[model samples]
Target: MLGCIWQYFYSSFLRFWLKWFLRHITGKCELQRICAGYKQGALRTSQIGKNCNKIIILTLLRFEEDVVDCVAQIMRHKNISEQKDPMFKVNLQQCLLQISGYNTLFAAVEDLRKEVFDSENEDHEKICGDLLMPSEKLESRITKQWGNIGFQGDDPKTDFRGMGMLGLVNLNNCGCAFQCRYSYAIVGINLTEMAYSLLRSGALKTHFYNTVAGKPEMQNFHQLYCYLAYEFNKFWVDEEPESIMEFNTYREKFHDKVKVYLQEPEVALILKLDAKN
Candidate 1:
């Protein structure tokens, strides 16, 4: 028992001595700082790889203070201008790496514009699953359902002309039967818009960086979207607001909720929807 206790003390002293020696000799290595940033939520794992490319440059320069400032900015949930500031160099690097994934999602949405809903459109029926109507009344029928799903106008197909295919798939997905009434298209669209708004406001980067830290993929991005949908639906009915008119107010509140949730490293963003539950 004494031997074991001595061994533990000896190892602890060795670690302390090594850190002291390294601190004096290296003046704080970049790798160590980067690791600290990740642990403290200032630097993301996704941001580390790119930083390696500038290892020599970063190591020679002292950015330890920047890291502290960056973390402070993030914890405070500062506006996006902080993204461009030197304090968030690592955070900026992360966003740069994720640009490809963002573009992929955007291009996928744009590709939908080319797909017109006509007799040739095989997915048209598939798009309107249980929502039935006479064949000749297709346009009007589509409009009412689209309106039900939160689209405007009598000609719904025209709206899809831009991101038609991509948007249609998401809309159809929400409209599908889930617990007979839980998966409302209107709610789904609201979540989509909310996610985009977060992205636009730049708050999404922190949550997203924490989510897909090392490798940002399209699936993970979609998963985030799905999380929003699943969460917002429950939030909507739980509040029991007077009407949709109060959406803007609630939307801001939900965004703040997500920011708070992202502060924890172990907290996961998951998508689980069940009407019966």
Candidate 2:
């Protein structure tokens, strides 16, 4: 017990000194623009510790370190597909919800989570399309398409457990948009995992706090998901990755690119999808 107490204090002491050192150097870095707002009157001097932690997190995000692999390791014994798991790497839910710019967006995310697909409120035919047509073909088609995307077996419905209608929405968007590439569902799910990591690392709040406009919404989140899905597919092809096993490796690289993009003060979370097409 005494040893644990000493270790705790020692760790806190190191963290306190690290924050002091970072606070002094944040102004000298090229990332000064990101630190500029924290110095303003809106955020108190006492909040300097909080802002310094954010600055440190973003700096870490710019590296190619495998955040997703860390996540996978942490969730190895559990079911990520079945639960949100509080994002073990970062605790940014309250931060995201409390920030004025992100409150509406957080609310929208909450609503999306509470939502489930049903015939009463959803377009059934659109959801199935050629993917789940003719009752007899359901089993084989589900295994072929959904399994290609990492779902366990012949039904994608149960696989959407924790992801809610958001999962179905992303799947539908990608499936319809890119039928030629079997990567649509995979990329969409990959982006979802990316979103989880960014949230877990607290890196996303740093980006969102600076870039988001007044009252961000679920549409904004969906747009970001689509952007990652589309672009990461290109990144995948460019790397000519030999196997899908390289996913987390490439994901970290893609994340580093995003961090590089976020370094600009003028950057916004908005992706110009039409321009890309």
Candidate 3:
């Protein structure tokens, strides 16, 4: 009860005066202070998003370019002077780019997820088959060979239902990059779902903000999927689970570990290819 009252009082009245006093003392608006004081990445960017006007940020969600204009507008509204704080303009621009880039990345991922995997498409078949069995030719489309790489059945098409092409893409791009100890293709697909859940929940903001200076692209998402796939594989082997039946429990443990890393300001969840050995 008291906590709710304090929150109401703070947002209703104390917040405005607090900002006014801070500006009077520091000669910087809340946004400017956030940019100046906090290190770049989720810490600073998340604060800017929280403190700024929602309408402005929401309007810029679709922005691909001209983010400078949005930053200028924010400065004008906040009465910030570029001459006094030259870095603020650049910093805020980067933050806006990261913010908008996250939305763009999510949309691209969603579109890919909606695209059903086509069994007849040569490209899809090649991508799927080559990732699991580069040297060997498949006996048939519905053969038991797919089980070699972790598919539950003879036909791998049904496995793509949840993540669609996104799962296959992650498997092909990230899974093949490493020599996995786990069931390569299916585990990659499962990890794809894990990556998707993280992206959907906005848990990757810290990692993306720290890694990508400007707008993140689809490649960035793919790279993150790669990191998760690699790290989770290493983690699974290290944990030495008694059986595959414990996958969910170990996956959750790995997910929690990754979440803890994301909470840090300097988190960059990149898979170091050189360190794979």
Q: Which of the numbered candidates is closest to the native, going by highest lDDT?
A: 3
Better of 1 and 3 by lDDT: 3
lDDT of each: 0.52, 0.51, 0.86
| Top candidate when judged by TM-score against the true structure | 3
What ranges in model 3 sit over 4 Å off?
Answer: 177-180, 274-276
TM-score of each: 0.53, 0.51, 0.94
Q: After superposition, how far is residue 125 of candidate 2 from its true place, in Å?
A: 7.2
* Total colliding residue pairs, candidate 1: 2
Clashes of 2: 1
RMSD of 3: 1.7
State how far residue 82 of model 3 sits from its true place (Å).
2.2
Query: Which 10-residue window in model 1 sums to the lowest lDDT?
Result: 55-64
Per-residue C-alpha lDDT of model 3 across residues 31-92, encoded as one tens digit per residue: 88899999887888888878877787778657756577788888888788889899999999
Residue 155's lDDT in candidate 3: 94
